[model samples]
Target chain A: MDSTIIIEKSVIIVAVFALTMLMAMYSTWAERKVAAWLQDRVGPNRAGPFGLFQPLADGLKLFSKEEFEPNTPNRFLFFVGPAIAMSTALMTSAVIPWGDRLHLFGRDILLQATDLNIGLLYFFGVVSVGVYGIMIGGWASNNKFSLIGAVRAASQMVSYEIAMGLSIIALLMMTGTLSLREISMQQAGMNWNIFYQPLSFIIFLICAFAEANRTPFDLAECETELIGGYHTEYSSMKMGFYLFAEYANMFISSTILAVLFFGGYNYPGMSWAVENWGVNIANVLGFGALFIKLCGFIFFFMWVRWTIPRFRYDQLMHLGWRILIPLAIVNIIITGTVILRADIAAYFGF
Target chain B: MSTVLIIFCVLAAITLATAFLTIFSRNPIHSAIYLVICFFSIAGHYLLLNAQFLAIVHVIVYSGAIMILFLFTIMLMNLNEEREVHRPRITRVGAIVSFCLICLVLIAIFINSKPIVGEYVTTGEDYQSIKVLGKILLNEYMVPFEFVSILLLVAMIGTVLLSKKEKLQK
Candidate 1:
């Protein structure tokens, strides 16, 4: 690669890293704020105006807290746990196309870190590996509750990942490309996949929740049962890392949901805006559109968290294995049939 | 000397060291973790070879899914207290014989295989991309692919049957 391309990519990577961190930080504040609002209370107004700096305050508190470690022999693995969680949480944003290309400095700049051809699979790989962080952390803690929580998380994530992958296969059949940029480009001007593949979208959305270990499916950390779940033995910045990773995961999954089902950076009048306005302005608007969709999904995630009760362990398993997986498979079959309808009609001489 | 060569060497060293650590580690969990690293390094090798799809799938299947299950099983077993296993002399001799025989066979195979004479040549073909890979697997390797699926299905059915039978006994 040329020096300019390298520089561009590094800048994009740093920007995305910062953006993910910002979103994750705000998501913490937003989760509490939204939860409080739903429950009819003032939430964190003491920090900055409207408690915007609450996350920062929380970070500082975590930093100042004493780093507590359980008397576990596997100290290295215990340390590796949060590091893995934090890194994997941040890694998923690499392939996401934040917006359409921008015309800057007389060069067309693609607003993504890297456009891997198998971007969807890359996302899956990173997400699947995310289980290790929890499993290792929980097991290393040498606590029965932590171990149970980790096991629950592992089974839950694994079961839902199947459904998630199947649901995306349906979308892939329509888009015929694994590149997020191409997927986003295909969804230009109100042609979102959600319109056509609504079933897949719903399946993917639910699986996204399960995968992120968000509420309703968050049996891993359901305070009533598991007592803080995998991070039961964690404290100080270590516990903070797990919490931050969860919010980061929620943010990434929300972004993925928007990018896959919703039109990503595309809006209803995107074509008109592109035709009338310049590419930079249009792309900036597209980025704003994507941001709105992702934030809306994030809010929806929190909304469901406070509203819906956590699923019973068996109920969670039943929903994933019996309901979602089969539904996702059926969605794939239906999508395939719809996509090849003309060919099938010709074959049947209809 | 070259950057690519340096990266390959680093990955190779990681792969070998992790593989050895996987075997030599006292704790089963540590072994599993090392094995996960070994799998990841192999995936890195695949990426180095420009087989991006293969690399990611390798990571997903082996390092991600399989290793998670392995760790789960190990953790559940709670094998923290190491126990010494006493193998009979004949069994130990047999194990050593088999290990050496397998190593000899692998070495012979490598020695017999044709060696590359020059720098690796790029065919400049779209062979490793997911689209082409899917086309090739469905078209040319259709029978083997279907057979593999059937094998997996059979295994799944066998597992379900075993578990169901145990439940019925209870």
Candidate 2:
């Protein structure tokens, strides 16, 4: 029985890993396609039909490119930077529940890599360490531009994270659980948290944008101003790793947003479908539903990237600290009041 | 049980080695990185105890926020070449003496605190989950919680005041 469980878990882990990579790979393609369509230009169409093989081609190019490095003293840290970035991006997928469960071989198989009790916090922890990648890479390069970019990335993340965490606290108070799976299950049958906590959702979305270093919040790599920002000194696959990590981070952030707010894997009439079609098919559909949600969120990310202009550094900080933090705190207070309304009403004889 | 013990030993080794490296590393940035690894190793120990919430929070607060800020400061100061060259040999001897004294003190504390006849018992995992931790914190530790918030408020005010530039009177 234990061995069977182990096998099932191993299979799920491989599947999740492959799926994350696949999504991230396509996200790069989709990003370019979206950008092209947005600007009234054809994008990467020369590399296989509709640029489907563009990422593969890009990968080969990056691999074949010269492994360039700045004449810096800290070569170890330079190499370690992308490794930290890639690993942290991948680590977040461990706690996220991809779907409900599968009933295979007469036993229930969990879709998550691991159902960590404090999954949300685990996600935040991984995200926090993600800063090290950019910082270490930039600093090790010993380039002024790289250093400035790393500093910007560090401060911007620090600011946005405060607001992000505060907003999540409000949601946590409402849900009363830290487990992502529990949060996902709570949003079953259209009782999405976004409906009740729209303010928090907006805060989270903005923070997600910032956290993933997406547009408007992508001051870290503002091309014209910083000349590739933190990665000005990096080249070849090391540079590719940083860029790939960003997309991976985006994928994970979208998945988190989907799970946290958008009724993850919970479509309308899902319970009915399960009753009629049995557990396996129902779960299969649920997984599909989650994929659909993830795609929608990924597309949203791309759409915003092309549409919105990047924020000035000071403006980003002001939004994160001056506006979002206060708003998130207010949200928490309001949520707390609503939660205790019954008790308050009882006391006041309402 | 043996597997858990082995894991614990590995984590302990990592934590101790990283902690030592954190202090002894020549580069300030390398020291900061070592500190982060040390923090992660400690977090691993927390996980073994099934205090998952504490483990992740430790990672977030220590490796995430604190370490990032530390790294930022180190970079901003350009402290890569921070090794002291003009320090007198006497000061180095004094530093070594102090370090040995602290080590001796820590060993004394460890030896004194260990119970003679009691086997360490597991706290059985239920207590450290976020929900229970929250309940206990809000109910029993409410005063300290409020106090901490006030302390943070004061610190924030102090930071703003300190960082803000004042206009000079003509």
Candidate 3:
């Protein structure tokens, strides 16, 4: 209720909005560049200084192009489809801890949109809502291919989210907190969780890849089969919204993976920096550390996209239910036994 | 008169309205979208409860993952408005009546309980953080945690079996 908190929250919201828009912009360029590099060809060299402005150009093109809606009976639902995708994509960033606190003008700035106690849960909830956009877009398109693509994407996402949730459970148990800020704090001064819970981290990494719907898990939009997947019938900016949402999801999920498992906003000798450089400078450095971690995960996403082949539907389901879910459960059990041994002994009167 | 109270009222109204519409909408796809709106509104309610964790889980589970399954089923079955089977008038009336009774009972129970509201305590430690939730699951609720694992396994097997079609050769 304090003015300072309100100001801090507003600043964070603005920053996250700016960050999401910027990431969505760059991801378009990045996807193209990655595709180009993989095929051993130069890409988008002319747009604006090494194709940096390609996303801008693409946006302009989409806007200029006439919006096309098929002769679907439900006009209201048709428009709602892309709006759902774009809004839900932006909503997930609400809980991401972009940085540690930075002191400015005698007021401490929290470098996140909203530091809810249930930050991870908030992320999961937002990510889940993301499905509506795709489903709506596909269903409203009134095309068989679009409908099929929607079906495929919906199934793929739901199957993988279970694995993703289970994977996080192991790390959550290890860190003993859900607030991303607290998780980041616990990972300070070289006590990164990846060292302690590598299995959980790996499973999380895989689930992250799947959740993003990148290559190998991109059955939703396989150009060969689904003809551009869920957005097949979409044209112009409506189409752009769907694609942009995908990248936004990718960027947010990457940031999450960094924060949760890779010592978000923490680095070696962070204490030394705080002691020497003061709280503001140290926190800035921590933010830089988080940014670096996020970029690494994003690059990993891109790397896997370029390298791997798509998973067959049956194979994808098999991995989710049979492999990833079970492994995640085992990881949770192991984490439980190790952390709760004392409590277990006490409970048994040992 | 508090901002919190006002926000809660708005969110609660939106949640209940959308939830009511979710079941009432003749078109299943429309019902799905309304359900999504309902989930989001519930997430807002969760925010009010200070159960940010549970709210997010609710969004992720009900809105994101579970709704996707519903969407897939709807699409795969091609249950558009044209193919949608309308409910019989008598059955529809019964459903509405039963729903009203359920709501009335729930409201009555809630009003009668007058649950003592706790003061908002800023626990220096976030007890419900994902990490803490994990710790509690492993340490305190370890048995239920294991049970959930078996539950998922059974669910997985059941889904595969249910979806499988018997071939003429078999």
Candidate 4:
């Protein structure tokens, strides 16, 4: 690659990295703020306006704390668990299309890091592997609570993953492509998919909540039952990594939700802006629009977390296997029938 | 081209080493983890071959889902290194013999086949794309595909039946 192209890619990679880190960091502050607001209390206002620097303070505190590892035989795997968790959290951003391509310096640069042909599958693959982090960490801790938490997390993720994949299949049938970039592009000009595939969107949203281990679905880390759950034995930055990875996952999940169901970066007068303003301006606006959508979804995640109580463990499993799975299957059949309505009509002599 | 070769060599080495570890590791959890590493290496090889669809699916199905279940089961059973019972001498001998025979057959097949000694040229546009794969699977392998789905449904029903606890009415 030419030096200019290399420089362009480096800049984009750095920007995406910074954006993901920034979003995750701020999500902690946002969560606490939202939670406090809902309970009618002042949330951290000691550091900067509205506790803007609260995340930084929290990071410093975590870093300063002592790191604790249990007396487990598998020392190596214990160390590797959080590293896996952190890396996998960052990895999913590679395939997400942040915005349409930006035209600048007489060359077009795709906003995504790399759009693999199998973007959707790559997403699920990375997400499914994320379970290893919790499993290894909890197992290596050699504590019953941690192990129980890990097992709960693993089974919960596995169950929700089926429903998640099934729900996506319905959306895939409607979109007819696996690449997230293609899906976003197809939903251009105010044709956001949520209008067409509302059931798929609802199922996907619920599954996403479970996959991210947010409240209501966070049976693995229920404080009263599991006593800190999977990260019970973790302290210092190790615990910070687990918490950070969850927020990072939530951010990515929100971005995925927006790109899949919402119009992504496609705005109502995008064509007008491209004609009047310019490609670069339009793309920048589109990026901002996408960011706004992501923030909205992130807010929704926190809102639900504060509003809803945690589900009991058995109830969680029942919802996953007995309810969501069957509902998702029906959604798929309905989506398929609707898509091929003309053929079905012809077969029935409509 | 040289970079791809280097990556492929690294992946192949890891795949072989991990497969051996998976077979020989005394700790069941460690063995499961080694098998996951082996699966990931194989997926890397799939990527090198430009089979993106197969690579991701291999990861999701094998390393992600199957191995997690394996690790979960090992943990649930509370299997530890100290409690692992040794195999009989005859079983060890038999295993060695079968392993050697498999290696010999693999070598024989390798020697008879044309060796790939040149630059890799990947041709065709979107040959492994989702649309192409879906079309081929539905049209060409439709029977087997449907059979697999039905088989999975039956397995699910069997699991529910087996695990269901009957009410002990007094």
Candidate 5:
């Protein structure tokens, strides 16, 4: 209701939007750079200042190019495809907490866009809807390769999501909260969840890779198999939207991985910084810390992508249903037993 | 208040309409997709309920995982535009008559029953959490919890038996 509060909320929203877009943009550049480095070649060095403007150049290219559509029956669904991709990609950021509240101009500015009690669930819901975009795009394209790509994507995301959800159960049991902010707050300083639930973290990390359709798990649209996968029929900005969504998902999932299992903006000396420097400066550092952590996860994504080969379809299924799901169930059981130890202890009288 | 009510009405319509379309669609694949729309509208309802967790889980389980399975079945079966089977006129008539009869009976029961409005009781708490759900499932609903494992085992065996290929005759 207050003017300052409104301004601060607007500022935070704008900042997060800017940050997500910027990250998605740079992800394109980073992918190119990493790909070039992996292949031992010079990646885009001709743009503004060591290819810093490469994303801009790429954006311009997408815009300037002729947008073509196949002579398909369903043009409406075709158009809807990329819109779904872009929107679903943007929507998942709603529940993520960017940082602790910033005390500015005598008002507390929450760093999150929205704090639904079930923020984690909301993230999963939005992220799961992301597959529909690809499925619709591929099916609507009326191309076999595109259809195959869509099927692969549908199967892959659905398969991996189970493991991802199960892996989170361990942390949820430990933290006893579904709110992303609460999860972050629980991880004060060195009490980051990775120390307690390393296996769950690893399972989640792998599942995140799978869910994002990154390497090894990226059997959905491997170039050798599906020829540009689901977006084979798309061109120009439409194609760009699909790729942009992928990179944006990568960034968001990495941010989540950092926040959930890693200490999420909580550095060792964060409280010290808050006490000595101030909330704004400390939170600035916290934001920086989160970014660094996020970058590490992104690099890890690219690193695994370049290092490993794609799994065979059967192997992918085996990993998802047989391996990851079972592992996740075990992790949940272990977490549950650990959490209810007092009750168990009382029952045993030991 | 009117705006919120209007929005709720539109969403509820979309939800129920899509759900009807899901079951009514002749093509199984179309049914799967309409089911997705139905899930989305339910998530909207969950947003209204302030049960963000259930909404997300609903999407994750039903829209994400379960629908994917349905889609996979459709794809694996290759249910193209041509393969749809049309039921006989009598079967169709029977279905329609039964559906209408059921609806009428439900409406009649509702109209005939005495109105029982009780005191408005607010939960006023975060009880629908994964943590709380787990506790309740393990403690109070342990019998049902254990029964699910047996049910899954029977289903698995049934599927294996049903899907077993016939022996070759030399």
Candidate 6:
């Protein structure tokens, strides 16, 4: 409630926003570069030194392109679609714990923008709302392909969300808290959730891929089938916003994955580092650790995208509903049993 | 008056306006969108009361899951185009009569329960936090909660049955 606290939070929010946008922008370049490397071709060396500034060039091109609007009845929704996508894509970072804390100007600064107790639910809520962008855009365009794409996206996201939520429940059973910061702290050092809840991690990873609409599961935007999918009618920076929102969603998903399963900002010898190197240095290294993990997940996303083929609509539905949901439920049952094993043993007089 | 009061008033205004817009919107998709906004404002009201868990769950359920389904149905039905359907005079009269009856019943209930409601009081207790809510749900409201789950399961089964492909008849 203090003015300084307000100022501090505002600074953190701005920094996180800039960081998210920067990461999303560069991810486009990285995706191209990685695709090229995998396919054995030169990606974008002409733009600026191995195409380091390719995303910037791409941004310029998108910005300068002629804005095109379809002859649709719902002009307002057409505009609202991309705006909603872009904003919701950027909103998920508000609850993520980017780092432990920083000692600066005689104050301990938390790296996250806000630490809501129900951070996990907030993430799910925002993600669920994200489907509207695609649905509204596709419908507003009044194109058949766009409408099909939007319907596919809505169904895919909704179906996958159940499994995703179930998988997270297993992890939640282990953590006993919904705050991402507490989850990060629980994974201090090499004590990651992945070690204990590997099944949960795998299910969560698959669901993350599905939720982000990334390949192997990107049926929503299956270009060959849906012809650019939901954003087929979009052009100029409006189209760019949809693409940027995808990358931003990918980046946020990777961050969530890293923070939940991987030891987020928690290196193996973090205690030793904190003891010897001091809090500031150790926390910086922790932040660096988190960065490395997220980047690794991002690269993994792109790697899978290039390597694997997309799923058929039926197959996607089957995997989500039949396989993933049942698996997640089993994982939850297993986790509950393990956690309460001692109680069960005591009750059984063993 | 206070910051909380101001926020409550703003949220209330949004909730009311969006609710009316949802009902009055010509396009089904627009109506769905307005309903989403209305749901969000109601969630905001929950947040205003410091019920963060309830607010987020409200968002995830109503705005996120249920409304997406609503929009999906609306979109699939292709209700974006304006269409006029003739209604019988009897149907309109019946609707109006039922609406008035419902309103009268609601008002009567509110008036009758006014004394029991008394005044708003803050207990300053950890009653609405997720941990406490979970405990209360599992312990105190355990039977009703289980019944709700059973009801949902039955509905899910019924939906599957209703949607399942019929067998070929000779």
Show the lowest summed lDDT stretch of 10 residues, model 1 chain A. Answer: A335-344
Interface RMSD of 6: 0.6
Candidates ranked by TM-score: 1, 6, 4, 2, 5, 3
Each candidate: fraction of true contacts kept?
Answer: 0.97, 0.97, 1.00, 0.93, 0.69, 0.83
DockQ of 1: 0.85
Write one digit per residue (lDDT tens) for candidate 5, span B1-170: 67668878989999999999988977676677888888888888886866666777788888877787777777567786686677789998899999999999999878753332111124344555666656767986799899999999999898877667443321
Tens-place lDDT digits, model 4, residues A40-62: 99999999998999999999999
- Runs of candidate 5 with Cα error greater than 4 angstroms are A1-7, A342-350, B16-31, B80-82, B88-157, B160-170
Model 4: interface root-mean-square deviation in Å? 0.6
lDDT of 2 by residue, A1-350 (tens): 47887888898888888888888888999999989999999988988989899999999999999998789999999999999998888889988888888887788888899998888988998899899899999889889989899899989998889999999999998888889999999998999999999999999999999999989889998888889989999899999999999999999998999999998888888899889998789888988998899889999999999898888888888898899999999999999999899679999999
lDDT of 2 by residue, B18-100 (tens): 99999898888889899999999999998897778888889899888988898888878765355555778999999999999
DockQ of each: 0.85, 0.81, 0.65, 0.81, 0.60, 0.81
Residues B80-133 of candidate 6 have per-residue lDDT tens digits of 344666678999899999999999999999897565334322444567678977
Backbone collisions counted per model: 0, 0, 12, 0, 0, 0
Reference-based lDDT, each prediction: 0.92, 0.89, 0.81, 0.91, 0.84, 0.91
Cα lDDT, model 3, residue B79: 66
Model 6, A194-213: lDDT tens digits are: 99999988988998898888
User: Of the pair 4 and 5, which is ahead by lDDT?
Assistant: 4
Q: What lDDT score is found at residue A213 in candidate 1?
A: 95
Q: Top DockQ: which candidate number?
A: 1
> Which of the two, 2 or 3, has more TM-score?
2
State TM-scores per candidate: 0.94, 0.91, 0.86, 0.91, 0.88, 0.93
Residue B60 displacement (Å), model 5: 1.6
> Which pairs in model 5 have colliding backbones?
none
